[model samples]
Structure formats: C-alpha cells, structure tokens
Target chain A: MYEGVVQDLIDELGRLPGIGPKSAQRIAFHLLAADSTDVRRLAAVLVEVKDKVRFCRTCGNVAEGEQCRICSDTRRDLSKICVVEEPKDVVAIEKTREFRGRYHVLGGAISPIEGIGPDDLRVRELMTRLADGEVTELILATDPNLEGEATATYLARLVKPMGLRVTRLASGLPVGGDLEYADEVTLGRAFEGRRLLDV
Target chain B: MSLYRDEGVVLRTQKLGEADRIITLLTRANGRVRAVAKGVRRTKSKFGARLEPFTHADLQIYAGRSLDVVQQVETIASHGDAIAGDYGRYTAGTAMLETAERLTAEEKEPAVQQFLLLVGGLRTLAEGSHPPGLVLDSFLLRSLAVGGYAASFDDCARCGRVGPHPFFSVPAGGVVCASCRSAGAVTPAPETLGLLAALLTGDWAVADASDARHRREASGLTSAYLQWHLERGLRSLRLVERT
Candidate 1:
C-alpha cells in the first residue's frame, strides 16, 4: 500500500464500477501529478453533476428538471414509446437518428442475481404512462441480454391485456460479421426472421 | 512468462477500467480462473464480443503475477444471445453459471466433471428441449454430486435403509428413514421424491412426465438441498420463473 492519502484516493477510485486496483492506483497517481486546476475542475464537475442531475419523473431518464428533453419535446411522436434499460441506451438509439418517438428508460433490467426485479425498475411509472391509452406501439429496446430479456418478457405479459402493440427489437447477426463464426442460435434466428425484399 | 491454451466457459465478467474487463472462466483444464481481458470494452476490440457470459471460447492466456491475462480468444459457442432471448432459460442458465463458479471455489485446479456438466447444461438450456426449471434442477443436482455433496434419494442418507424413504431432509443429505429423519425433515409426496431421484440420475423421461405439483415440490427440495450444501442461496435461482 502507498502512504495514507494516496492509499485513500486509490481505494476511492477502485470503488468506482469499472476501476480496479491497478487502474485505481494509476489514476490516483495521475491525479496527484496533474495540475491542481485540472483536478479541481474534475472535482467540481463531479459534485455539480450529483447536485443537478435527476431522473425524469415521466420516463426515468437522466434529467436536470422534472422531465427529460425527450419527454418535453413537442415534436417527438407520443403515439409510440421506445423502452430501454438505461439512459446510455437512449444515447445509443439517438445516435442512430432513426427513431422519432418518445423514450421510456427503465433504469435497469430485471436481474434476480443482483436482487433487481421489475419492482426495482421504473415499470410502475411506465404502466402509469400507458394507462392513458395514447401510445399505440410499445417497442421493447432493452439490451439483448438475459436480464434485459427477462424484464421485457415480464413487461410484455403485464401489458398484454392493455391492447397495445408490444414488440421486441429483432436480434441477429451483426453487420460485417462472418456467417461461419455466427453461433447456431443466432444463425437460426436470422433464418427464421428472414424478411422479403421490398424492391 | 508461461502461455497456455484452454477451452472455457465465461462464467462472469466485471468491468475493470475505461476499456477492459475482468473475466471469470471455468475451463476444462484450468478449473475456475480469473483473468484480465485488456481493452475488451472497446468497440474495435477483436475478441470483445466473444468473451461475454455464457460463451464457450478457446483462449490463450499469459500467466501474470496477480492475475492471468487473456491474450487471444476465439468463440466456440456463443450461448449469450440464445440464453438472453428467453426469460425462463436465461434465469436457469444464470443459476448454472453461478453454481459452477461456487462449486469450483478455487483457481487453476482441474475440474473436468464440472466443466463438462456446465457445457452440457448450457447446451441443453439453449436447445429448449425440456422445461428450463427441470433442466436447472438437474444441472444443480449433478453439479452438487460432482462437488462430492451428492444427495441420496433412493436409499436413506443417514442409515442404510433399503426401500424409498418418505422423509426428505437437507441437513441429513437426502431422503431419510423415519428413525434417522432430522427435526426439520419434510415428508414430500412419493412422486416428488421420485422426481428428485430422476433429476439426480438424468432420467429425463420420468422428470418430464411428472405432474406440476410434484415438480414444484421437487424444485423446492432441490433448492433447499443446494443451499444447505453451498451454505448460501444462489441469487439467480430466486428470479427463475418456474413453469
């Protein structure tokens, strides 16, 4: 271990989600050697973010006010809602520039191993939003992972009686991927979900 | 700087830094090993997608002082997408992976039986042949057996009694005679006991044909038995939507 303050800094950095011990140590040292003004700016930003950012009351996406920019936008389509697991996923979908509908951030997927279930997410809020019957199409854009799938399935069953058109994102081979390297399950899905040419 | 190659299943993964991950793998030869996959979080990384959980991969690892480093990885079977697409199967598969990690409980020790069982369990789960719950129970029972905690269902676990015992006790190993039954022993239905036995012995026909009540009872007993042996409940098991 290093001296008192250095060790403390390293430990704190290590506690972050993706920062391990070695990386923590490297970052701590980099900070110590960095200009004081830069470190101060980073510290200020961290505190500022914590003080300002909050979840949108309507959709659970990160926000500075009661609602996120997407929820407040008048131009976006309110008839369709794209549900995702996290705010980062909203950014990812936004990068595509293809979706013009509103978004509902679930905050996280249903992961029993982590003691996270539908109750722990923003499902109730989503149900509240759907109660109005304004949304005609509900697209489940949760990650194509086990937890995400579980969450999607649970939501699908819960909302089945509501008469909304519920759908999940189609998953298959990634672009530029080799067919020979594709797993049997994914390859099979691609074949089963094959679509006809529109030309 | 010794380098070696082995086929392994990605049991779990945790982010390490800006663009790296710490992967826990259960390998055919090296048992359960923790290794650092540098820059695996980067979009341009060659083997990033191949090292996800539930994936069976061929890996070349360079042994490091604190942790081994994964140098190269090639996908053998990517079960992640398949397992993730279904809820029941996903939860079952997660429990299986957690069980494998818990059973091995050591690094670099050869556990060929555990490895094979995990591979088989995942393959069966992905195939969606039988109920995911039944498959999970079977995998858990077999894994416990491989870990030297095999529960006795046909005969008494404590005393050497012959015929099928009526009492099932987690603390006493498995089925127990009336005289050898523990304080908290439960008298499950005869069918439930039969279902448990079928699961432990890979009798899928008997297991598949069993009624829902018996299956639920068997599942409860199997989970209790597993927790008793592991000294803790598996987190993934609680989330499984039993069919």
Candidate 2:
C-alpha cells in the first residue's frame, strides 16, 4: 500500500516488542537508505538467529548446537542444577561466578492473565531430565516477578513430590539504599529472608 | 446464561465482612475484572483456595450489582502453596502480583501486551528457572515498556541522540546526558545504564552477563523509574532483593 518491500519491513518491525509504528517506519527508511551490503548483513544476522540459535537439547538454553556450553561442559557440577527462565538467565548467573553448576532454562514464566500455564514451558523436559536421579537439588532462579514466583512454586510442588530438594533465591533490601529509602515490601522481605551471621 | 466459565489469576483479594471477599483478577479473555467470592472464608468452602491470590482458576461468576459473584471454581494452578512456603519466591511473587495489579488498572483495559507479560512473567517465576530478582526486573522493565514508560538507555530519553550516557532521571523519562541531568537526578554508572537497557529490552544476554554490582545499580534505577510511574511505589517491590 505504501511502497515496495519497505512497507513489509515496517509492518514486521512494528510487530517487535519495543519498536513502535514510528520507529518501524524510521528503521525501514533507514534500511532502505543504507548500503545494500549492510542491509544484506542485517538480513543474514536475522536468518542466522533462526538457523544457528536453537534451544539446548538437555537444558533448553539457546545454543548453536545440540547442547548449551554449560550443559556440555565437563567441569560444572551436574548434580546441582540452577533452574532459570531463559538462556539469558544463564549469562546472569555465570556473571556471578559464585555458582559452578549446570542450568535448566524454562523458556518462560507463568502468568494466567496472558493464558500461559505450566504446560506452556519446557517443564516436562525438566521432569524428564530429573528422572535420571543424578541431580540432588534444584535451585529455582526465575525472576522475582509474579510470573517467576508462580513458576517457581509450580516447579517446587512438582519437583518436591518427586522427593527432590527445591530452593529459591533469597530476596532482601538492595545495597545502595538506606533503611529510610527502602519500601515496606523490600523491608519486609529483608527482615523475612535475613541471613544468619557466623560471628 | 452469560457464558459463565472463564480463566483468571487472582491478583488481589480483600476481606469483605466475615464470609465473603472482593477479588481483583486479570482474565484470559475479558481482561481485568473485579468480583466477589461468597463464603470463601468459611472452612467448608469448596473453592476457597482457587480464589486466593496467585492462584489460577477456571471460574464461573454470576453477575452482581457492584461486582460478579464467584459461583463455581476449579483450580488451574495452585501456586500459592509452594510460593507461600518459600520466603524468597513468596515476596517476589507478591511484588509481581502488585505490579500486575497496578498496570492492569481500569476494568477491561484491553492490555493484551500487559496481560501477556504478567502471564509469561508468572510462569517463569513459578518454574523456578531464574533468580527471583532477575525475574522481577525483567517483569518490571517489560511492564514499564507495556505501560508506555519505557526507559531509554543507548539513546537520549528526550532528544533521540544515541549514546552510552549514564545519567538517569525517571521524571525525564530515561537515561540522560551530563548536560541533561534534570534537577534531583542521580547519575547512574555507564554499566548500570547498559544493564538497564538490557533489562528494558529483554537482552538477557547483556543482563545475565552483567556483574552483580551493575545489576544492582540497574535494579535501583529500575525501581526508581517504576516508583515514579506508579506514583505511590509498588507495595511489593520493596520485598524483592536486588542482589
């Protein structure tokens, strides 16, 4: 209706999460005005994302091959599995360097408002992985959001019934703020999840 | 018959008299709704657990004068039990619930994006896949984006100039320049800004790759931005641990 392939690009880009109609048009026009080589490069990258990036066979993380690096690695502790929502969360945990365990990505969290249920994620795969009896504990690392919490609870119930230990990451007050600055909820969490000092 | 069956997550429930309660829910098809659960507080009630907060239910609610009355209910996911047992998951879940409640204001607000975000967020949380803090941040960033208050990171929040500036002024929208720091603004570190950008955009590669300090810094910015937009601060966010 508007132009050639430019119209299609705008429509597709507009479908992205943050890109709006205005941004879509701007990006489409930019692509049209850019060098053909760069445009082709962008297209290649997009194609590669689908072709090259796939879920890890064992853990469900985005990987270039059959298994994600963490799942395939020999050094990490397979007995300790850190359960997280997406492949991206693996990166977050890796950055901490405090954990040396393998991971299981759930792909997404649960929110009934959006019609997402426990059955929608890679949860069944997790149950399958746990059946081997190699893993001793499951550290639920889903985000501290409602969906993440719901996901953790759902998993704990399912996993615990199988006689596996399920744990959640602790919540508390942040570092850069005084007690005066913290909200009632954070304060409550900090008080509830208080860590014991070994003094 | 008004087609009574619908699926919804109980966002919040307020005690009403002794045996009844008011429930706020976000439905799969009808969007946000407020309803009453009669005698839900009684010990012998059939579906009390199904109507509790954080519980997903397939419900039939008869229309009432002020609110709909829950007639029959089936538990879709009894998440509250597992969540309530763990302090961390419980707090994080509460924060998400409150945030969802705040975002889905205005009955039938046609917030398809928000509805999806909450559902997806809750699922991730329930599965115990990521750290609750990370999940909360993801939800907050996405929620803000859905609410039209998305924070800018690589670009100026006001001017559209692409940058890696670290200044964050929630009232000014997002990241700012040295020159654009609004009055009473805090200049977040460049790393913090980058982390925030990743969170805002769901670039978990960037976010998960960030250092703990940077994630915490970004989280502070996120909370401030969320509080600014929500006006009265998210009652549950305080319970979430940033680290």
Residue A27 error, candidate 2, Å: 71
Model 2, DockQ value?
A: 0.01
Docking class of 1: acceptable
DockQ of each: 0.42, 0.01
Worst 10 residues of 2 chain B by lDDT: B41-50
**In model 2, what is the error at residue A53, expressed in angstroms?**
69
Candidate 2: what lDDT?
0.77
Who wins the TM-score comparison?
1
User: Considering summed lDDT, which 10 consecutive residues are worst modelled in model 1 chain B?
Assistant: B40-49
Highest-lDDT candidate? 1
Give the residue spans of candidate 1 off by over 4 A: A1-45, A170-199
Q: For candidate 1, write residues B1-243 as lDDT tens digits.
A: 489999999998877868888999999999999999998766445677778789999999999999999998878988876777687788888889999999998799999999999999999899888899999999999999999999999889998798588998899899889889889999999999899889999999999999999999999999999999999788888877898
Candidate 1 structure lDDT: 0.88
Q: What TM value does chain B of candidate 2 have?
A: 0.90
lDDT per residue, candidate 1, A1-23, as tens digits?
99999999999999988678999
